[model samples]
Target: MGRKRKTKIFMIMIAFVLFLAGCNFNSSESSNEETGGSEGETKQVLNISTTADIPTLDSTKAHDGIAFTVLNNVNEGLYRQDENNEPIEALVTEHKENEDKTVHTFTLRDSNWSNGDPVTAQDFEYAWKRVMKDASPYNFMFVTAGIKNSEAIMNEEMDTEDLGIKAIDEKTVEVTLEAANPLFQSLMTFPTFLPQNQKFVEEQGDQYALEAENVLFNGPFTLVDWTHEQGWKYEKNEDYWDADAVKLDAINAYVVKDPAAGINLYETNKVDRIVLSSEAVDQNKDDENFDTILEPEILFLRFNHNHPVLGNKNIRQAVNMAIDKKSLTDVILKNGSTPLDGIVPKGFFKSPAGEDFRDINGDFNTGTVEEAQKVWETGLKEAGVEEVNVSINIADSEDHKKVAEYIQAQLEDNLPGFKLNIKAVPFAQRLEIEKAIDYDLSLSSWGPDYSDPMTYLDMWLEGGSANRMDYSNAKLEELVASARTETDLEKRYQMLLDTEKILLEEDAAIAPLYQDGTAVLMRSKIKNLLVHPTGASFSYKWVTIEE
Candidate 1:
């Protein structure tokens, strides 16, 4: 997930993967994880399924909130944007600001608790200070870094008060920003800034958050049951302040990725929705439930610049220009994955002139064994080396393995003296290995940060967390820093372009491949279900069932 910028958005995003009662994999019951059910009757359950198992629920430990909170309306932030992308109050009743934009205040909406108590501003205060104090790494803390002394507080230099949040009363809260962020209200729409009950969390200890009874939520739903391998389930939380608006009575989410099985479940009407493969699309294109969406997920190869051979631009570029993106898109991801040109995916940020990024005309000299060989030959000659043995790491999934296999064939064909080896591991495990730069080459995926160009462009900066490449460029770092503060949208975009140019076209530390829209097969009965631009899981809330 390239959600570094959306740290605030995903701070509250955690895990919740469930299985079924029949298969222990299809049950998707609610727990400490999962969401989505019918409105009036407890018998009406929406059995949903997915392809990947959630990683973990610890926000500080896991990036994606699997086993935690991909969906479920019980948790909420200060503000939330509606279908029109308009920012509106969620838990907060009103937002007040000073004339100078230096001070901000919020009035809570009398948000309720599962135990019938009023949700108060203290909840937000506790959650905020806790994350900063504990080094929660929820990314939301970073958004507040612009606040006075926030960075220092996160680094333990000052107390929580200096960190900039105050609960004046049971319903009132105040915050001071380092600078006026016009998007601040929209920023509050993220889960990171949401209120977490201090009373409830303190009582549970470490294990409290791992189950339903250990936590309290003020959202539209409540956690019912959760067990290992059995998917979580959720029912309506009638005590919520805005319970009347909630349409779903319960939501069943199953964590299984087998496309064939998922399709079968959908066919049997056991699943309300599922994700299909390119092959499945070909077969189900005519089915009524067949609806495909182009989502924000992008796939690419991250060079372990920490590796010996990866330090060279030539070798990196040879590998970068080698893979056939068109083949990957047209053949593998028939779900409309646009082949990338520069680091930023096409249409990451559109301009009056068109998209803000670059494209190599659907042909970046990738995919051809001959081109790879030529670049490799020159790279080897420049390094004064006759042979280079490299290992390419990939996720163990079938789709990922196919990608690795194709690239291996290309590398072997292009450079006879160079040996290409495959290092395959589970998706999450591969991420750990890649983070440590344990391989010469690794392929991975990233969704966006915000709806900004900086999300894709800033990752390659020196010392950036996402910069597993161990890549450093003085000029690149300068550009990234400047872009963050530029504020001028157009100028900021140009800064991103320059950064991408240096990282992809010039340094070649990373290879661009495909950007795709996620594909979803959903029950036509599922209405008001809006898949966010961020990714697939930021769903469940803001959705209603018609029947």
Candidate 2:
């Protein structure tokens, strides 16, 4: 559902990179005769920009927002989020659940992939089990969703065939969960759960999804051209089950890392949308088309617990306290971003008592530099060292680099002998290094995979897929484990509340920097484009262009 809130600032540092990328689309070629629009005749074309390239198109391996946004448009899932952000059936026409709600059966409507292959229930079963077998970066989603035997399957304790999913018939798919999960249907909307054609995938092997032609599409649009580091094109899929609902005939997306270049494209009418950086925001704030969205994405500092210097709780707490979050958000990140002292962003969740999670949990590590110095000195004594030198790995984007530099300066200035070396690398490479646990600190971000708090809380579990920080806390782990199956709303809510307390205030496991806000300029003609707070970022199924 659209929770479009207007704010003063425009643009997201991390999400900006996800949504804009390079393209060679000619502006003159965008308009063409297309049928079906509120206006008798319309251009029926939408051009946009993103800063980073899609890492991979394969749904199984897609871990970044860039890949998720692209895959979500080109592929259909059992369920999809509606404009209101609620789960609605997509490929599935009907669904039934058993009394205990551990088992779910879905009946599909007729659909075909871009290659004219029938989309069957077997595809869903195949794709899901394949994620487990391959140990995808998002494999833990199955376990968090409470899928039956998913934990064992991911851990190699059980065969993937034993997973709680099967194709009962040509159009019927069934799933069994270890416990009744209320978010199961919503989880179906996530990109990680999208179905894949088994035959086509096996045929292409490693080449599958590496290029536009190698992939098959069953959603509203099919990716027709992908020029590696350049841009890509999406053409309307006539065979889509709900093609009639898709208004745009084509969408041309490009990679434009430079804000000035993106603004130039927008000014020249070459592109319909462009996200502004902080500097650009000041120049464009007076424009009528300027808009902003407070996304449910949080950028935070991840501490590698395996590192000897970082493993010290005092050091981690000092790191969290040394930096001035208010200054970072107000000055450096002036695009409506808010300083976040808690891991969970505001407005994302409410307790059983109807209180906002952030309101109830309050803030952590909002102390002054003097307090940070005290903690840093204590940490130095405990570690038997005079000073500490650690590197922070970050995405190689202008915005991220600026933020990392600010953090480096803050730690060095406020924490006495602390020295922070920033290692800037491509986004995809940064993810790889973090996954291998090779970095001391990492500037990372997390967007909700689902609406539940577990999406953020579960990652810190002893061996959770996203626990690249190597953090382990028995109390936090116990709370998450119990909350997963705790049916009582009040009790479950309390467990989660306590979990955040232990994570931030008690353990200082990670330092939360800010919650992102997206500022962009969009052509007034573009209508009905859905920007989701979680799962896939954007949906173009109902987008339209005016005459």
Candidate 3:
């Protein structure tokens, strides 16, 4: 899921002369030929730009989108997303489920790690248990906590060895679940479900996954060079199980924080693609290479329940109702993002009856400025406070800073006796502060780890890992827990709907802002690249460079 939303901020002006002189192209491009293309031609290299440095590489600990994108390319789980974005078998050749759906058996397809060791079923069992350890801070543990005894093992009530998964033989692994879960197969597609080489990890200890050489890969690419705060390179893994299907010889990504630097790199042919800022979008709307893509991520205002002002339910409701989402999406962003009225992003999930979730919920708590001001006054009186001052935490990106500024002005001007403060910090630092509950409010976001609405709802449960704001409601938690085990399709759907109503409409736990839709500029020569709306956002397995 998203830790920080993707918004192309205003580019900083860089010296054009220095940029041109730093990157010099060889006159004889043919001499550099080797990795890809027809035999003697120059190798196919795909270069791209990312907004920030990757926080971590460990599959068991990686949670942010940037880390997940890199992990998805370097590691293969039980299943992988195909070209159509549907789950297809990757490491497992076949699988069968018991009649009650509590037990599942999978037969492994023979594969090798980049280090030349045979990938075995034990690797999967080991990795699963590793993340479920009580000391680990893995955020998505609940996604798999339905596995038999997983909750007990994670809580330390049962030993890790007592958990449900067992390696029947070198090629087979069996898993028992606490109950029937409809999303089990889809959960296998995530990076957390990936198999890890136990011996290698144990050998490296604390240093594992810190660098390219410390770990092994079984997917299309092998991470070779990772210079923190600089960039990383992914070279094709010739030993990968399906190497023949991977086209690009290498994928190089640079941590380009400034949009202008990214633009310079793209124009000089150093990078193949770069997402553009609002200014760049405006200037290049008619360019054939420019396009806008919607992401299944929503940005929201998370209020800390520990704060005196934020603890008041009416204050939270008034804040949610005041904002003009249309202005934020239309005028401020100008990047095709849709204003959100629900926690779940539009076009993300469809029910068994084939109806969209957002379409069913409609709009809630999106009221006029006048209505918000009245509610604000009433809330202040009820809380017995003359004036309230609160700080809004945000990422230290140009786009995020602008968003904070807009909201600060909106609330101060529209709500009586309200004062706003702003704090902008680097993405990594922001995460630590949010976890410490060091702010009154924060501009936060989430993208589904899988395709289920549970990905969004489960995080707000009383003691859920991602609920850093401390927001909670007993009824909402009950509904979410019941939805997990509910067998009837219609009943499950209704439970989810009820959970949403309680969180957004009744409790006003969070302020819904808008769904992210990003715009980018790319070289037309890159082909077969995919940007999926859920799970790992980008897939380059089939990508090819055209001559």
Each candidate's TM vs. the true structure?
Answer: 0.84, 0.94, 0.92
The worst-scoring run of ten residues by lDDT in candidate 1 lies at 10-19
Per-residue CA lDDT of candidate 1, range 1-547, in tens? Answer: 5678477434322222112443333342232123333354333356777545545443333454353354324566677656654556787777788987868998888667777767888888887777666655344434433455666674567886667888899989998887776556655655556677787777777875676676676776776665534455667777767777766667766655456666666765667888777678788777777776665667788877666566777787787776667777788767767777566666556743575455422224344567677777877887778888888888776567777887788667666677889988766677778777788888788776356666666666554456777888899878976876677877866777677777766677677778774466777767776555641234455566544
Q: CA lDDT of each candidate?
A: 0.65, 0.88, 0.81
The better-scoring model by lDDT among 2 and 3 is 2
What is the C-alpha local distance difference test score of candidate 1? 0.65
Expressed as tens digits, the lDDT of each residue in 384-487 for candidate 3 is 89788999998876667777887888888888778899998877778778878889999997888777788888888765668888888899878987888888
User: Cα lDDT of model 3 overall?
Assistant: 0.81
Could you give candidate 2's per-residue lDDT for residues 1-547 as a string of tens digits?
A: 3334222113343333344333444452434543334555666889889888789999999998999999989999999889998999999889999999999999999999998999999999999999999899999999888999998987789999999999999899999999999899899999999999999999999999999999899999999888876688898999999999998888888887777668866876768999888888888998999987888999999999988889989999999999888888888877889989998899999887789998988899878889889999999899888899999999888789889999999999998888889999888899999899999999999999988788889889887779998898999988998999999999999999899999998899999999998789998999999999889999999998874
For model 3, which pairs clash?
Answer: none
Ordered by TM-score, highest first, the candidates read: 2, 3, 1
Compared with the true structure, model 2 gives a TM-score of 0.94
Winner of 1 and 3 under lDDT: 3
RMSD of each: 8.1, 6.0, 5.1
- TM-score attained by model 3: 0.92
